[model samples]
Target: MPDKITIGGVSVDTRHWIGGQRVASAETFSDSSPIDGGTLGEIARGGPAEADAAVAAARDAFPAWAATPRAERARILHAIADGVEKRIEDLAIVETTDNGALLRSHRRGVMPRVAHNFRFFADWLLSLEHEDFDTRGHRNHVSWDPAGPCVLITPWNAPLMLATWKVAPALAAGNTVVLKPAEWSPLTASLLADIAAAAGLPAGVLNVVQGYGAEIGDALTSHPDVRRISFTGSVPTAKHIAASAAANLTPLSLELGGKSPLLVFADADLDLAVDLAVEQYDNAGQVCLAATRILVEDTIAEEFTRRFVDKATTLRQGDPRDEATDIGPNIHARQLEKIDGFVQRALEAGARAVTGGHRGDGQYYAPTLLTDVAQDSEIVQEEVFGPVLTLQTFTTEDEAVALANGTRFGLAATLATGDPERAERVTARLVAGTVWVNCFFVRDLQAPFGGSRLSGVGREGGTWSFDFYCDLKNTVTAPNGFTDHG
Candidate 1:
């Protein structure tokens, strides 16, 4: 077993969340590994006090940090990316131990993506250019300003990667940040703070606090000093945060849950569809953009289900650290229980388990595929953040689009088809933020990533993230006579 880790720069004798250089407490909570029911460490049950401290620290640093030159800020981000690359192994181990994600997935899939995000945004900052608009006979110019101190709350499923999605842009836009990492997986956030310090970030520029949502999270979201809040989690939690932000009229960016769909046309490459489906369930379907509701055209539904079931059944589930393991345990026991309940409810509602519906003693659920799930069932409507996919069939293009858009989620969609005209038509009609014509989960950091509707507002990644974290200011100039006449 690994040794217990400490937050901030000092080691505390008692369990408490650390902000800046202080040890504070609200309650005590033990963190356990999902791989086995073994205690990993304990965090100070941080409540309102810790959250306030973190916000204060961010407010204090905002003036200097925001005033810093863009080039200098870009340098710090680049250096942190370098530090992360150097210690990839250590970070991957801690990430897997905390969340039961496969070590290879973290090392290969997540780490590189984060590194690319930093580099891509760093270049964006350096090359940022103001737009000049001609307003009739007057001259107008636009400038982007930071949104002041920001409160960032991230989920456990893809902690580091998702955190980077916000952090890189917020920093690039010159905002001080107070980060609240999910209690289930705090180790990676702590390690990231250490890396930032090594990269020469100013004191209090980035603050991390770990605790329950009701306690610490409420304080951060409601704090007056926090000018903006960016959160990624469930839809219900997002609604609560939205309300809290509304009370203060603070700006927010919420990346809520999704029940994303994948459309398989009759002309789609069958072999490719099966491979993508297997990979979609690779991380146990914890991803917000997991293509869970597979809508296949009736003409090919039989063949696709047969192949999809065959591949999904062969996925290896075991210890996350094992290199060959394809699927690891869920993030926690509670998550496993929630997933089980959803499956059982769907079964009772007349859904049939096509393959792999068994649960192990540990926090592990086999990759499950269900058929004949009612369109309005909980399994189809709710975001099941686990390794489960419910298959449905559609006879026509209009039916496929209707079924895909049935849920409130509009995050992502996958369309596999060999027909070029059909791909173009379906891709244009899909009500999703991202549409993959021939692939699934394949993304580039330079592309804008986000959802259309309840999947969340605003965008992340590419040059768009800079716009999200910054406030656009339009400057207009006119001759004295012209202004007086108007």
Candidate 2:
């Protein structure tokens, strides 16, 4: 709600964060509150020109930033983390208002995780290793180098967190970035730019742009100066970015969609299973790794469904700002419509709505649970991305694994079982980037986060994130003799 958001110690004139400054163009878009459909503010609608300016700024900053020592760069990132910690309440307010995430969750769960991610990556930057390899009289050494200019495209669901997954690492790895935040929720992204600017990141090193994907995203993807693209969004967009990057052979890292499943075994704790199911659906199942499908062992399927439905039915569905509310609205009206269409299609295809299957308004869809969902049904296969949970029964472990891995997405899977051996075995067999044994939806910054197959291309968190943002340069030194010109 500030008149002008500050970034890099500079007060930008525009509402939206773009080109490393506040940007106000003739074109503008209104940011609306999903909870009550209230207008938040009008943000600048950046197109190709803004995208070009952002990319140019990043290109200009890359040389000097990349040349800066790792320790100094790490210090800047650390300062950003400190700023985030200081303004946690303000950032949380903006994020919750814009994205419809629970205020408590944004403050306690999401913001803390983001802070940890930045700090963890900052530590990794200080400890990064470049080894000297000596192989049979060949003195070879390898050093990590920045990837130059990077284009970061983030989604609207977790606007700030997901964007930081790319921005923090790219910046810490010494690559200047042009960040294109999803237009629907640009508040946190803009606020982040303000925080980064206040933390003393060089102007061009971190830039934010707002616009439709076709214009700004296309420009960022096709720009000759951008050496890498890191995106977190739907599979279709990922495919587009991947293809565009392929044309120029620019390196890319994508964390796409997922229809992740949770397998509950006969020996599992039913209470705990129900608890996790409710928790995973807390953000209305908008999270990428949300346990949308639950494949339970036949012996416990009936009881699990009975209890799960009861717990889900008890969830409070209303405004995100309400402390008593357990679930909130979807990010937008179109998202609610999309979710409704999926639910209706599933019902038409003989799926039984075990519980809620209705929409309250343009943004709020009732927390829903569907049973008897066909294996090939769109609701089961595609990413509904709403508070809709589908159930299927499996007789054996093999069947459970098959059902869990049935979808093209392999983002995450959860196994709830008391048997340690079975948990380990099922964890290995489940084809997902992150597997939760006896739990679901829990993660740490130290853990490497990403998915496999159509889920994504590269890891996002931990030390491995540097791999996506930096390239390796190998050098060889002769003991005393000369080197070959070739």
Candidate 3:
């Protein structure tokens, strides 16, 4: 389009990356920076044509790429990781300017993990060995064959990190990928496409088509040629994608919404508990695993609420580019309004805002903590997806578990307790995919990750990732070396 736009001092190209080339769209949309609601640049507005083209390219590339040696694929993945490490600063700045996440966190934590996503998957792939066993005089060999063309859809929050989380595993499993990033922050995905190309990825192995879901989602997810789909977003959209994918019965993995809880036991460390509770405000509470609903034991509920409010109020909200700022603005004006509405409605329903309950200048909203909330109210049961926390009191271990599992969402939960036995006892019973004991937001990439019930449909991490990206085939041979023992 127009020469090249400088975003946060880094040059950016805003075109769809398909078949290892930059392709322009018939129409374009102006992208904005949430920092000050300023126009960043014109991004290609892709439609069905682009989506079809990307899938076709992926389909065309799958055979040769899948046939390539695993070691060579691993080498290419390492190269991609190297490219990501080299451009961390530029990637972090462009992501922050576009999505309104804290720049410092991006530079320090998010970007590094983005690189590790590729490295870890590559190393994990190289170490894996499919087992072959004998069954009644026959040998059964287990193999994970690469599935064909696939589609990956990621959300706006933590765009690159999450996209690469899916992309790394899919690519490592030898599947061709057509990544459709969220419309809100699509720039970095374009950058990543270029990185993969520079890292010696074959044409059409990795493609990016950026557009609004309404315009391009159906085309990508509903394509009959798409063998697998991985999506991370809201429940409604997940349902939409599922419906479309069901036509071809295409296998899909969904990582969806949550109204998770952080339970604090009376015997827990007060400092650790308060710190974990306040961390729900990080990323402006845009995280799907955020423990927005807090259940504190009756004995320490008052004190915990007081400390949580004080810490939450201390969070510095401002421009995302500022190193000193703890939280940045909401990604869009509508998101700001939606966040405030949740607080306002809670206030109207007799919930008390102990710290913050209003909006700041531009797209920034105050980190809010609500108390005296009704357990059955929408504020406690629904995912606000904002810088808001709701507190309730629980008298015993059973009550705490009940409150933690109260919502339909079983995405994640945090339990704070001094007793190891209780941590084991209660964490086992909590209805969630992930449980954090005496901690919050500590992630180990090798562990299984996803939600139960409404939060999501499947898990993805380590072997779980490969399981989803590849198909299992068992080869049985009669009279093999070890099969003589019946």
- Which numbered prediction scores highest in lDDT against the true structure? 3
Pairs clashing in candidate 2? 6-194, 7-197, 8-197, 9-197
After TM-score superposition, the amount by which residue 36's alpha carbon in candidate 2 deviates from its true location, in angstroms, is 0.9
* Candidate 2 global Cα RMSD: 3.2
Q: What is the TM-score of each candidate against the true structure?
A: 0.94, 0.95, 0.98
Clashing pairs in 1: 16-44, 27-45
lDDT of 1: 0.82
RMSD of each: 3.5, 3.2, 2.3
Off by over 4 Å in 3: 1-3, 480-486
The local lDDT score (0 to 100) that residue 91 gets in candidate 2 is 74
For 1-486, candidate 3 gives per-residue lDDT tens digits of 583689868888888889988898988888888899999999888889999999999999999999989999999999999999999999999999999999999999999999999999999999867777878878888887999999999999999999999999999999999999888898999899989999999999999998888888889999999999999999999999999999999999999999999989989999999999988988999999999988899999888877877777778899888899999988888888888988899899999988889998998888888988987898998888889989899997888888888888999999888999999999899999899999888888899999999899989999999999999888998783454556
- Model 2, 1-486: lDDT tens per residue? 345543323333345454456666668777788888888766777888888888888889899999999899989999999988988777777788888999888888789777766787888898888667787777888777998999999999988888887888899899998888898887777778888889999888888888788877888898888999989999999988887788789998888899999889889899998887777786878989999998888888889988988888778888788888888889998899899999999999898988888887658888888998888889999998998989899998899988999988999998888899998888888889999887776777667888998999888676678877889878887775686789
Q: Name the candidate that leads on TM-score.
A: 3
The 0-to-1 C-alpha lDDT of every candidate, in the order given, reads 0.82, 0.84, 0.91
The Cα RMSD of model 1 versus the native structure comes to: 3.5
Expressed as tens digits, the lDDT of each residue in 1-486 for candidate 1 is 122454223322233223345354645688788889788676666789887777887888888988999999999999989988987777788788888899999998788777766777888999877777777767788877888889899999988988888888888899988888898987787777778877988878888787888888999898888887899998789889988888899888878878888888888889998887777787778998889998999989899988988887778889989998988999988999999999988888899999866687689997889998889899998888998998999998899989999988899999888999988888888888889887877787668888877898777776677777888888898745354555
Give me candidate 2's TM-score against the actual structure: 0.95
Q: Comparing candidate 1 with candidate 3, which one achieves the higher TM-score? A: 3
